[model samples]
Target chain A: MDLHAMDRYIKSLIKEAGHKIRNSFLSDISIESKSDANDLVTNIDKEIEQFFISRINRDFPGHRIFGEEGFGDRIEDQNGVIWLLDPIDGTMNFVHQKRNFAISLGIYEDGVGKLGYIYDVVNDDLYHGVQGGGAYYNDERLRPLGITTIEESILAMNATWAVPNRHFDHNGTLKLIQDVRGIRSYGSAALELAYLASGRIDAYISMRLSPWDIAGGMVIAREVGAIATNFRGEPGNLLEQDTFLVANPSIHSRILKDYIRQK
Target chain B: MDLHAMDRYIKSLIKEAGHKIRNSFLSDISIESKSDANDLVTNIDKEIEQFFISRINRDFPGHRIFGEEGFGDRIEDQNGVIWLLDPIDGTMNFVHQKRNFAISLGIYEDGVGKLGYIYDVVNDDLYHGVQGGGAYYNDERLRPLGITTIEESILAMNATWAVPNRHFDHNGTLKLIQDVRGIRSYGSAALELAYLASGRIDAYISMRLSPWDIAGGMVIAREVGAIATNFRGEPGNLLEQDTFLVANPSIHSRILKDYIRQK
Candidate 1:
């Protein structure tokens, strides 16, 4: 596959999707609950997902699509070329704040990530990476993440994860919160990972996230020397929901070993 | 005192200060630690404070200034007309993220908040309120905060406050975190308050915040029918640092009564 041509096509497609999202803000948005009240889905989300699916199918007839909105194929395996898409990553923020949400998309070939793109729609920042080509934030090239100690790092994660939950020991997460210089929660996993690539933040932790939520981010973060893994220090699952930790390479293992204790 | 005229003048001064802050992003900034390593102050912060001080001293000679950088008068009481200023709220974010920081300024007359301003420099969003008039985000008027339940609200606070600390029982905070739909930490008290006033967020809590950090936000929040008080249920102290809770009036008392236990 000509990855260069595909990269250019995806960038333009994401930008077009972002434009539609911006226009949605001026119109009435219909919202619905997904798994629960907190798990929301809006008309805009489904619309944007369908928009991408239609375009991708027309432009690249051979590429298989896996999407959060279920508008794409149901794949039993990560074979051939697959496009992972999260049309709107932070639906809660979209419904309430009308900001802090993004379009996260990633492309993989036989389970190997080749290109990633996360467009911060509100901020108009597009973060993309092409495997060995490195990452770029908008027009500027992002620098490789340098060494950072936990004591001097800013960690981003949902505050819910630090409270008592079924996923892990809350005490361990609480202790990690105190050990870091500061904590931030932007309500979007994709944006948090994009921020890590650009050095705006050092690490991100999530108790539960889907493949589409981290696919684009993982590709961009890897180019900046960041690491992505489950709590068990294994590669992130691209076909299932799981706990995730993406951080600067300097402190990823330390956080995983000392602070992540599964219940 | 003609508050109308003062409000107009202050608006222009804040915009000018915001312009200066935007310029500082292009120049080299010297950073230093205050109180602790995480507590940071930058050359741009001091410069911005001095710039506001000089202008205020020249324009309104009778008004006393209470600022974060200690460049203004030593305020002994909330008497006469006073200008409370935090030239750069969220100095750490200013140094690290170059965004999410704001210029917060509040004017009070005989202990009564009269006018408030919070300028999000990078985004060019100016939030202000005139006592008895109304609050505004830029040109649009902000509506009074409608009722919201704890289960359906978004709470903004420093995540550290939910960890074991000297200020209060961490358990109460943890319970509150679980009850809320979401929690956000933008690292700027002024911006958080501005967000609350605009209904972007429903509640805000801080274990320790000074007058300058909240002076402007209180004025704006009050106009939108939000309540601001210390953990003990008294008015927020203007003369010293104290625990603070500012929330939509509907859930303010509930959170204070059930979820804020002083250790």
Candidate 2:
């Protein structure tokens, strides 16, 4: 598929969705819990997800979707064109802080990511990428990520990695926590991945994330020469949830082999 | 002695210092490690700290300075005029992100906080508080913090608390992390406190902080009726380093007794 036209259409749709969200932010909107009280979803989240899914269904029929709100189709495999959508990536941040949330979307073709977008709705910034056509923020073409050691790199990860946990070897991740220059957790996975592309954060690692949580970010991170892979160094699971580590080219191998990869 | 005059002078100093930083950013500025490579202090941080201390000493001759750099006086007591300053509150963020750091300053007279200031140098927004006059963000008077529960509250804390650690009961903190409406870690203690005062975040916790780290923020947090106390629910250490917990009034006692209070 020719990406130029697709990219333009996606961008317009994203901006439209963002405008809708910005307007609702000032009005009366109800918020509800998803799986738990800590997991939040606003009326806008449902509306936006439905809006995107409906648009895709109208524009490109039979294209599958894997969305946070269950508005998308039942995606079985990464067989064909699948659009992964996280209408509001950081719902808790959106519902509570009223800032720091974003709309995340990614397009994959034949089991491979082709394009991605992460829009910071409040700030009106857009990060987008085509598989081979380097990432761009607004109109500026992003340069490849710079190389740095973990000690010199500012990681966009929570301090929780420094503690013991059931998922990863807590002790090893903790060592990485102390070995790095600093750690940060911005509460938005999409924004964090976008930052990785922008070189604001050298690397981002999370123990577990769903497909919608990272689809858009994975494409953008790759455009700037960053690598996105699961803990086992396999290509990330687009059909299922798994651990993720996105980092600069130089540090990805080191982080996976030295710290995050199991002993 | 008048807080209004002191606040005006401090604000001006902060603006001028910010101007100097803005002018010098990425222009022959030197940066080096303070403790580790990740902990950076640019020539700007040192220069800014020195500049603030010199101005304070000249304007208020007998005032004691407690600042990030060693230029501040060795403050041994809370008596008399004590100025706490963090030249660059999020030094790493300033060095890396160039957008999130701020200049944080707080003043206490005779063990009573009389004034506080947090300047987002890059954005040119200032949060100041004069005792009994109410907290102000930029120029708007801040409303009193609302009473809220841990389950319903948003917490601004590093992600490490969600995982197990030795400093405090990590498991207990993790429970609080899961119980709260949301969790955030912005990497700047001062701005986090300002947000707490303005009710953006209901609570903030950290394992260790210096007198200069939170001195000004403690005052601002207090004015909004938020509880600014150490983890033990004792008075925050005025002379030495200690764990800090500042939260909304309704949740402070519960957090202390439930999560932090040692058996």
Candidate 2 chain B: minimum summed lDDT over ten consecutive residues — where? B159-168
**lDDT tens string, model 2, B24-114?**
8759867787776556788888899999888888889999988887788888888898888889999888878887888888888878888
TM-score of chain B of each: 0.99, 0.95
Query: What residue pairs clash in candidate 2, if any at all?
Result: A159-B160, A160-B159, A160-B160, A181-B38, B106-B216
Candidate 1 residue A222 Cα shift, in angstroms, is: 0.9
In model 1 chain B, the worst 10-residue window by lDDT is B158-167
**For candidate 1, lDDT tens digit of each residue in B1-263?**
79889888888888888898898878899999999989999888898899999998998899899999999999989989999999999987888788989999999989999999999999999999999999999969999999899998999987887788776888999999988988999999999999999998999999999999999999999999999999999998788899899999999999999999997
Candidate 1 has which clashing residue pairs, if any? none
Model 2 residue runs over 4 Å out of place are A159-166, A261-263, B159-171, B261-263
**Model 2 TM-score relative to the real fold:** 0.92
Off by over 4 Å in 1: none
| CAPRI level of candidate 1 | medium
lDDT tens string, model 2, A69-105?
A: 9988898888889999999999878876777889999
- Enumerate the candidates' DockQ scores in order: 0.78, 0.45
